[model samples]
Target: MVLGAQTTEESGAIAVYHSDDLKSWEFTGVLEFDVTNAQPGLSPDLVPRGYMWECPNLISMLDHSDGRTYDVLVYCPQGLAQQDEHYVSSDQCGYIVGRLEGSTFHVTRGFTELDYGFEFYAPQLLSTGDDAITIGWMGLPAQDDNPTVDAEGWVHALTLPRRTTLHNGVLHQVPLFPLPDKPQTQGFGAVATATCEHDETLSLVDAATPRLSTWHAEGKLLIRRHLPTGDETRSVVCAPGEITAIADGCAVEVFSQSFALSVQIFEEWQNWTTETT
Candidate 1:
């Protein structure tokens, strides 16, 4: 079965196809869903609705906590609102845990953002043996203001390959491959065992510009990055969990059971620091 989305900001729909040879395909049905009714008891909701739904991937993942296999849909929807309280972002990468019945994809748990960073979209899943890994573009559409385009003549990068699984009913991703390295930069990787009871912040900081940081406040994980005029930030309300981070030059990736955040820091030196306050 193949599920494809209409990549437009005015409307959203996914086309279902049936393939027997894995090459030739035939149309089966369209899985058009209402966002308001997609989730039953999930928090930190995705845009009440989305206009542009791109790269709709459906995977069968085993719920590790329950030892049961279930279907998971990874969706990239553009055209969400800018900011609502501590949560921000319009181009969103999220997932829905559900089951497919003949022509219908029913929701077990509605859409939840997969990445909580500045740049991450259209993730594609690669199956390995009985497991799977996902990789996404570490950049966004119409966000081409990075200094590297002028300094090095190129821009953007792909995220580290991540291993995915389900715990309880929630999807979790962890870095599967080492961070990619580039010239003139240092390689940094470590498991940050944070006992963040109240608040904690991990950041790529510089004195001159707005910092790129991921922190936990209350029970939400937030990522803040720079924009043309000022800056923008987003959050996923989650409990603290195991976190692992990697850096090679301006590229940084953070991972945990709760969320994954990736960003490209346009700086000569990538200095990441963690603070609990």
Candidate 2:
């Protein structure tokens, strides 16, 4: 793990460490930041605190545009403050952009890799066979103020697991497989031809008690179908082997393996495997 930050008094520095079992940690001392120092464009979503010179997160993902995998580092510097008010919002947060080459890690550009919804901090990489999963604390800087602290006594929650990949020189995230199940209800017209939108929505209901129950959009991918009792939301986006339904939760967004999506709709959940079209 690598860490970089600034002290409350404005002293700036970066460091590295090594751990075999996570239980025992050996500090590898500070890492050298040789890149441009004008404005380190760190992420503002995750780390809210200003004057940060600590806490570092390293993310490893494939730069498919380049074919090889790259490791990116995010850290803080306590002394470096920008003229913008947004940069000084948190004292507990800061960021950086670094890449890993062989065993050596070096800071490269000065832009925040994470540019999306909500605050995502302390991000780490998880190896899942062929993919790298990125997850981090949704709350940072002052963790105490987070609303989840009241319910779970924990100030933050991990961002939904995102399969990270580079597309057309841009980073893209998609939700993992297996999805949350929604209760069946009424509303859908039929499984006939329906117009599809990149951002689509669908619904169904229970025939016995249409008023008693219904299944709302629990994930990004939805299949237009009949009312009451239908199967799971496993229909591919349009065609099989194209962009199939990856049943996660609302956390799923427009994630494509190449650049297209897989879609399919079925009669019912149990018959998902049996449905041909």
Best by TM-score: 1
Q: What tens-digit string does per-residue lDDT give for candidate 1 at 178-216?
A: 544332234343223343334776654442554566677
Work out the TM-score per prediction: 0.78, 0.47
Which pairs of residues clash in candidate 1, taking residues 3 or more apart in a chain or in different chains?
none
Off by over 4 Å in 1: 1-3, 7-9, 32-49, 82-87, 178-195, 200-210, 226-231, 240-242, 268-277
Q: Write the per-residue lDDT of candidate 2 for residues 72-115, one digit (tens) a residue.
A: 55454343354432333233233344565544555444444342
What lDDT, from 0 to 1, does candidate 2 have? 0.41
C-alpha local distance difference test of each model: 0.66, 0.41
